[model samples]
Target: MSAPPDQGHVLVWQEPVQEAWIDYNGHLSEPYYVLVFGHATDNVMDAVGIGPDYREANDASLYTVEAHVRYLDEVSAGADLEVRSTVVGATGKLLWIWHEMWVDGRLRATEEILGVHVVGGGSAPFPDDIAARARELLVDPPEEASGRIRPLRRA
Candidate 1:
């Protein structure tokens, strides 16, 4: 998919919460949130021409270097989920992405990720065309992007 016409977030992925994703407390589990966000990342890769097809042809792919995820609200099993994603920034070899998960128009979670283009078991610059396309979709990072977990006080 191409960048949104107004340079806003793109609706990158959609899926229902899986039954197995629910935890014992009867809500969507933490790891599953990351899994769904990872799928959104894959969709973003596809949008910028670095998907599985490209990986097969070029022997390269993008790998996440870091990620921060916030679970804003509880989600029940079988909820219809929609993920909106933005290319917050891009360079020759790196991409910064932001993703929001919405259920019935309510924000449930958010994720920010940094990824690097990798080839031959090491980081590498993206092909010119792919880099240009990624840059074309770039938008300003969200206010909450790049946040870190708070440290705990010693007892």
Candidate 2:
């Protein structure tokens, strides 16, 4: 499927591995992978204007309902990694995102995330405006992965 015209707005976050993130094998620790992806998700949310302030103003925030990650390569400590994210799809209360982590132009990992907007006071539906904004950022799933689209599998 083709990417959305405003795909340039998709966020890219670059981070370098720290000593603390390294394991005895001299590679990034397993847990750090999730941590890094979490940071990348924050960057994407900020780019779409649904960041901290927006959540406070609207009394709503995005929550990760599920995430599927595939580690393709090892990234050693001190390696610089780039994370690129795109909104694969979005509905009234759900969002599907794809993230790729690359180190020195080589793919290291890929993550498919499912999220939802919930009211700050409770787990309720998001307001109309927030839902509309999310829809605008949604895009068609990649052609090869078209059949993979499905409801999130909560971790």
Candidate 3:
């Protein structure tokens, strides 16, 4: 899908909490949370016009260099999950994104991601059109995207 003309957050992906994804604790497993977030990232890539076809055509793609996820709540099986994503920023070869995962209208998780555009096995500038579209969708990062895991200080 092409980038939406609107310049704000977008609902990029949705899926149900599958039975197989449940853990012994009876909630969505930790890895599954990352899996869903990854799917949302892929959708965001598609929106910005760098999906599989683009990769195959140009031998270039966005490679996630770093990610930070906060799993805030439990998700039960069968719950419908949706991810809202924002293009926090983008440059010639780097993209920053924030995603919030929602279940039953409640915020369940958030992930901050940094991806680098790669061509021929090294970082490279994004194609002009793709960069333009990503810029059009850019928005300020949310409060949750502090880019740090909460500090751990114990007495």
Task: Residues 33-68, candidate 2: write the lDDT tens digits.
Answer: 888888888776765567899888888777988788
Error of 2 at 94 (Å): 0.8
List of clashing residue pairs for candidate 2: 1-143
Rank the models by lDDT, top first.
Answer: 1, 3, 2
Cα error of candidate 2 at position 127, Å:
3.5
* Candidate 3 clash pair list: none
TM-scores of the models, in the given order?
0.88, 0.82, 0.88
Top lDDT prediction, candidate number: 1
- Candidate 1 weakest ten by summed lDDT: 146-155
Q: lDDT scores for all predictions?
A: 0.81, 0.73, 0.81
Model 2 scores a TM of 0.82
lDDT tens digits, residues 3-102, model 3? 2333355745778888999999999999999998888888888888999999999898889988998989999988888888878878788888789888
Q: State in Å the error of residue 15, model 3.
A: 0.6
TM-score of 3: 0.88
Candidate 3 deviant stretches above 4 angstroms:
1-8, 148-155
